[model samples]
Target: MSDFNSSVNLTMTINGVPRVIACNPADMLCDVLRSAGYTEVKKGCDTGNCGVCTVWLDGVPVPSCSVFAGRAEGREITTVRGVEKEATEFAQFLVAQGADQCGYCTPGFTMMVLALKRELKSPTETEIRHYLSGNLCRCSGYEGHLRAIIKYLEASHE
Candidate 1:
């Protein structure tokens, strides 16, 4: 019912700054954001199985690769870069726990962890595991990630 070749202009608040980007109606938000210079939104399993392209759509984390770009019009989208300060602090914990290897999954993992912190406040280990189940890591075996999350959460509450 719509022209596939046509580009649509979408205005989204990215990292607290309003940006207008042109993308095809069928373009995925991950592709659009990356093209618009938000490379922090990585592209992994474009089918949404992998959480590599997670971004906060209006303060809720969702897989950008599974979302249509046009759906983000006039909405606020927060990538990992949007929470640089908190992410940086959390990254320290990640490194100390040896969870920052490869880094391909770090951005999305960070977004999910940050969301967990905000939403859960003080989550149990099982809750943390459940919350992060969508994110998969090929390296580190996730033990390091779990340690890093526990450490980060402990530090945050102090």
Candidate 2:
């Protein structure tokens, strides 16, 4: 007799909504999220090198590519869209400061920064850079990104 446990049913909260999905043992969270309509979770360098697929797993920032969908079965998943309201001001700052070039990696950067904002009341330049090292950008060259993050950090203190 064949085992029926190869694929598992996942019941997780996504963007504050209860979500139910089925995933195979080897399916990555990124693939499952995209399948479930969370396109904001980008698929960049699916080997976990790029942070484009970054998402919040129970309030912690993690690369969806490195995580299996089964791992999120009962946790809360927050994509960039989930935190759009919280990251809007920071996103605008990046745009106004000319930091959002090309815009491909902006969602990932925004998501990661939004999580950082939740964890830190204020972050130093070095800390910002360190925290953002995972997400790679080629168009903006990270100049505008760094500046915008600094400005966001400063503004939140006021």
Q: Each candidate: what lDDT? A: 0.92, 0.85
Residues 13-125 of candidate 2: C-alpha lDDT, one tens digit per residue? 99999988877746899999998788878898999998998898998989999998878988999988887777787888998788877887888888889888888667778
Clashing pairs in 2: none
lDDT of 1 by residue, 43-148 (tens): 8889998799999999999999999998999999999999999999999999998888899988998999999999997899999999999999888799999999
Off by over 4 Å in 2: 1-5
TM-score of each: 0.97, 0.93
Best by lDDT: 1
User: Could you tell me how far off, in angstroms, the CA of residue 70 lies in candidate 2 after the best superposition?
Assistant: 0.8
Best by TM-score: 1
Error (Å) of candidate 2 at residue 97 is 0.9
TM-score of candidate 2 relative to the true fold: 0.93
